[model samples]
Target: MSVCKERAWKTLEELSFIRVAGTQEELKAAQYLKNECEKAGINAEIEEFEIDMPVISKATFEVLEPYKKEYHVIGIGKSGTTDENGIETELVYIENAVDVHLNHVKGKICLLHGRLNPELSEKLIKAGAVGTISIAGSFYDEKSIADELRPRNTFGKGGQLPGLVMHISDAEELVRSHPAKVRMVLLQDAEKKGISHNVVATIEGSDLKDEILTLSAHYDSVPYSKGAWDNATGSITVLEMMHYFAKHQPRRTVKAVWCGSEEIGLVGSRKYCETHKDEMDKTIFNINFDMTGVTLGHEICCVSASNDVMHAIEYLAKLENNALECKLDTYSSDSTSFAGAGVPACTFARLAPMGGAQIHNHYDTMEHLDPDSFMITLNFALHFAKQLVNTTTNLIPRKFDEVITKKLEERKKWFSEEKDEKKKESEENKDEKTKEEEKK
Candidate 1:
């Protein structure tokens, strides 16, 4: 009935696998979590949603003119496809692809140093770049996984260019070589779709059954990772909390959600909010767990709610002697989805120090986590949630400060612009098709 670290660890081990988004493995993990909740006498169900799952058939990057050699690469999903013979053009190193670098990138394949956000992608498309190569991994990465480039996709609408992600070491070499010409071949089905799931469990309150306290953790892992520290630990943490709440019924309803496809831009959580939009009015708070149970890490909480709530959590941590650093900001996890939907939310994580434990790769195994360290976070979170659930009055304010409100507004504007761009592109294509038919 209590939060048992050992039981949580065992469950984490059982669900330890590469549960990539929209894959069978991810569905299996979702089902497993649903079953575990049912076994605890909690009512659980799996809600399915569609996700973009592009299929890359073949992708290659080759250098010509200076040195004739090919490098291993992975295609960027949804980034359009190249011709049968691929695109051969001058290779230009654009460092960060600022405006200064874009002046000379016309009809060339640009090499970008950092992340390729939607704004940058739009700039590149407007600058007439034929293809792109993004860097990934560190030069000091272990030889075993040095070549493992994580697959990524272009976000937003339109401005889709064929792209590849190269290892940092390889990218360094390619830039140093100063190859005049390069060829990039990307063949894929960009319109493909797949299904992902969210496991939802509910424990009705004794009095205020309408009011809900949502507990969430993503269960999906990235490619080539078992996700032990990145998220499997968080998933189990929520499960343990569910076990506790099942035994001691709170005054407010408790909802546990194991989100899927979170690694791919929090798709699962966003969908959960949209599907349950009608219930958002009654949802009081959302407590999300991202990562925990690291051997060498510190507890942190990112509160996307009001400053009052943030101060309360900080005070509670200090009162309980829990070494937690609480801050008022939007975290890049499922909690952000809830916050965007006007639900006061926060994400609890035990972040590892630099050179401690890495994630999103094969290195994120159980080697860096233990049950004792795991319990520390779970215990503190239990105390925090218990107080709120049993409190006589709702302490969380349903308002964001000016800074948080601005940030949320900016996010909404960006998403709105993306939708408008997509609609415009769709209309343009339809116009072209109609003109062609009229001519025929």
Candidate 2:
């Protein structure tokens, strides 16, 4: 069946409210997703969890000018005691907060180029950045991508300073507004704690029912970002796939997971795995779809650390693009949780920005989505699931190295066949040229 790009983009465009870590908007998106899954005929349900020192939406803040609201502080922030007047420090531009220069951040306000990586946030806080300023570009469509891309917008007050992230242009304008030793006095909610839930659905197989395969995507997004591409694309992709598969039916028991709080340190995936370690341990593989569909370039790349999984994914994407190569040992996504544990797993995405990173920008929106890419990914995943189901003897095979080696061997034969075809084409061209010269 044809999946309409206009319709898919419209779906993401309408849910501009979804953000990460259990906000009202996120819940709304979740409910909408659950409805979609049910409508498509998939059995779906919610799974909840709690995070200690959670940087959820409730611990919200904004830059106030003592009398008027100056900058709205979105997401998590420091909550304990502060220097009443809020630390007034000069702004320091951090090219990459994740790779922050410790010596330079001491007692200064930090301006980050992209979204915050939690690891970077902890390190920078430890480095002594009084606060943080982030730039969110215009192309951002999904909130999930923002949550993962941005530093949890959280702060643990009294750690020498606080942090806040905002759009690049808006931040530039905010920083320029009355630039005289600008002081940002924001609140930190270290004490506020809460709960978040993940929704899971299962399609049991009769044969190897004990073995399992998982398909995952975060249901949350950043507070301000609707998370269309960041994850609404991913989350929706899973539901759509689930609907299709449920009707078509696969051999292995497939679990469709709508993870929660994934935007914050993989909390949802981590918690879910922990809660179902027994069953998860039984899992042979996990297929993670983070971002799919693009109005611009469509470079569906596969990421996996295991040799076997990588070999399999790369084999699946062999005919994609010569310039766009699918990595064999790449492992960075919601699937990292399971993949890290040695359960053969990999992540699927439509595009990979030049080097080796996701298109971590707001421009990763519906405006840049291509429905054709989405359908390709959806169908490829469906076929891959079929292969995985058929290969019941080797889910997370005992030796991933062997798995990849075997797959690569097959690839060599395929490439040879391709080369032979090109040779024939060249020969045909030469023949045509010879005939023309003879006629002349």
Best by TM-score: 1
C-alpha positional error of residue 329 in candidate 2 after TM-score superposition, expressed in Å:
5.0
Q: Write the per-residue lDDT of candidate 2 for residues 305-375, one digit (tens) a residue.
A: 45555665666666542223466643445776665455566677766445322344444456656677667
Give the lowest summed-lDDT range of ten residues in model 1: 152-161
lDDT of 1 by residue, 264-367 (tens): 87889989999999989999999999999998999999999999999999999999899899999999899989999999999999999988999999998999
Assess candidate 1 and give its TM-score to the true structure: 0.95
Output the lDDT of residue 72, model 1: 88
Backbone collision count in every prediction?
Answer: 0, 38
**lDDT, candidates in the order shown:** 0.90, 0.62
True-vs-predicted CA distance for residue 169, candidate 1, Å: 1.1
